[model samples]
Target: MLKAVILIGGPQKGTRFRPLSFEVPKPLFPVAGVPMIQHHIEACAQVPGMQEILLIGFYQPDEPLTQFLEAAQQEFNLPVRYLQEFAPLGTGGGLYHFRDQILAGSPEAFFVLNADVCSDFPLSAMLEAHRRQRHPFLLLGTTANRTQSLNYGCIVENPQTHEVLHYVEKPSTFISDIINCGIYLFSPEALKPLRDVFQRNQQDGQLEDSPGLWPGAGTIRLEQDVFSALAGQGQIYVHLTDGIWSQIKSAGSALYASRLYLSRYQDTHPERLAKHTPGGPWIRGNVYIHPTAKVAPSAVLGPNVSIGKGVTVGEGVRLRESIVLHGATLQEHTCVLHSIVGWGSTVGRWARVEVPPVTLTPTIPEPAWTVRASSRTGSCCLLSPSWAAESGSLPRCSS
Candidate 1:
């Protein structure tokens, strides 16, 4: 049997996801009409021999998270549990901290995934590679342009043998085009190295004159402390994929990831896509509408739109390339494009909520106009380009 662990960083970690993370934990934030990490659970459940799944994070197991876990367990028929960390543990720390729980069932191998990434999750392919060599570490990697590669953990692999010769975490200089996807498959033997890192940190902690200055001995960065250390030691290998993959680090990236997943729904979850019934809203392309959402027939939504539960779309409303979150109401004739409608907020009649479309490419920086919701009011105000130019930064709006 196999298991999967999803590392969702705690509250202090996803500050980039401000207001949204304030309402819901980053892992529970909706993407493509579902909580972001649900995609990870669904993908893991599909893998053969997959036995259980665990979520390791520092967030309190609140009601929303608890409900999600129960639903996932029922839907997937697998034990889905959350393992909370009392303190912030780096990527590898949680794995080592919960080593006994993870190894209890003697899983053949377990998959470790980061919560902030979106991908097709080529787990089976990675499993095949692992079975062939039974390497201690199998990292999923994909190509990025030379410059963008510097933003991620870069891997230097022996092309013919696929052995990772060297690894660098967001190096200052150009390293390699192949970047780590934050997805890994590891044999049980992998924990040994983590134990070593733990022991080393403990030893180093004792020598520190001021222990408070240390990040804590429990912190273990999987990339720097493991992959980078084990490269070329005949323990780490890389599996390259040309599939759809992107990191959801900011609001713009989340919007782009929504589009990517919406497109994938055609093959993966067609029923989730909204359809044009006789009197239903006119959906132009891939769209997801929760059953509880009330959209008027004249409203037009499409080409990558997700309407969450309790949302109300009025007649003649135009929504495209956006997400309308739960409990939001778009009044009649309101035009929303390239933005996110915050939960429990209402757009006035005929209001136009928009921002220039952002096209994500390695060469272009993410657009500055992606409006983030306010944690206090669950609403956002968009600033004009001129105001942004004058201020040299986007204005933070509330209510």
Candidate 2:
């Protein structure tokens, strides 16, 4: 049997995805017409012998998350569960803390995925590689440009053997072009190193009493403490993939990741992609519209657009490269381009919600347009044109 663990950090994390994270947890945020982690669950479920999937995070099992778990269990026919941490535990800490739960079924190996990433999840490929070598650690790696690589965990691997020779997490200087994709396949023996890190942290915590120190005794950074330490020991290996992969660090990246997944729908879930039909909304490319969404026939949505549940698209509205969230309304002739329309938000007639469209590239600095919902009312109204160019900050919405 095999299992999968998804590490979805708590509210304290994903600070970069503000306003949206304010309305819904980052993991629960919709991407490609479903909660972000649903894609992870779907991918995990497809792997043969996959018994169960566990989600480890510090969120208090709120209503939305609870519903998602229940729905996933029903849909996947597997025991999809959420293991909440007492406090904020580091990536490795959660795995170590819940070791027994993961190892209970004697899984041959379990896939560990960071919930913040979007990928075509080459789980089966990694599993095949793991079965061949039986390595303790198998990391999913992908190439990045030199300048963008510094932001991720870089890996140095033997070209011939594919063994990880050195590892660095977000180093000050460029280390390697191959960056860790935050997707890992590990055998049961992998828990030993995590335990070692936990015990060492406990010992160090006892010796030093610095209140300012972060990542207390229980916190274990999987990248720094495990991958970096185990490199060159013949225990860690890399499985390079030239597939759809991107880190959903900010809302801008979320939009970019949405486009990636929407494009992927053609291969994985073609039925999910909207088809241009007689008297139906004119869809240019890959578009996912919920069944309940009421879209006008003249509304043109395409190329990469996700219309969520109960959304209303008015006549002649043009939506491209955007996500119109649940219950959002685009009034007649409104144009939404390269933006995210918040839940229950309304863009009045003839409004243009857009930003200067940057050519989508594999790099991380692309501009983003966001329509932030009102924290007080849970909705906003865009009466006039709104533009956002920066990826790091949320734009002010006119209520």
Number of backbone collisions per candidate: 0, 0
lDDT of 1 at 177: 95
List, residue by residue over 281-370, the lDDT tens digit for candidate 2. Answer: 999999999999999999999889999999999999899998888988887777888878787878766666675678655465766343
**Per-model TM-score on C-alpha atoms:** 0.92, 0.92
RMSD of each: 4.8, 4.6
lDDT of 1 by residue, 1-399 (tens): 999999998989976566667778989989999999999999999999999999999999999999999999999999999999978888999999999999997999999999999999999999999998899999999998888898999999999989999999999999999999999999999999999998998987733365555477788889999999999999999999999998887666778889999999999999999888898799899999999999999999988999999999999989999888899888777778877777787876656666677675432566656333232334445555444323322333323
Which residue pairs clash within candidate 1? Answer: none
RMSD of 2: 4.6
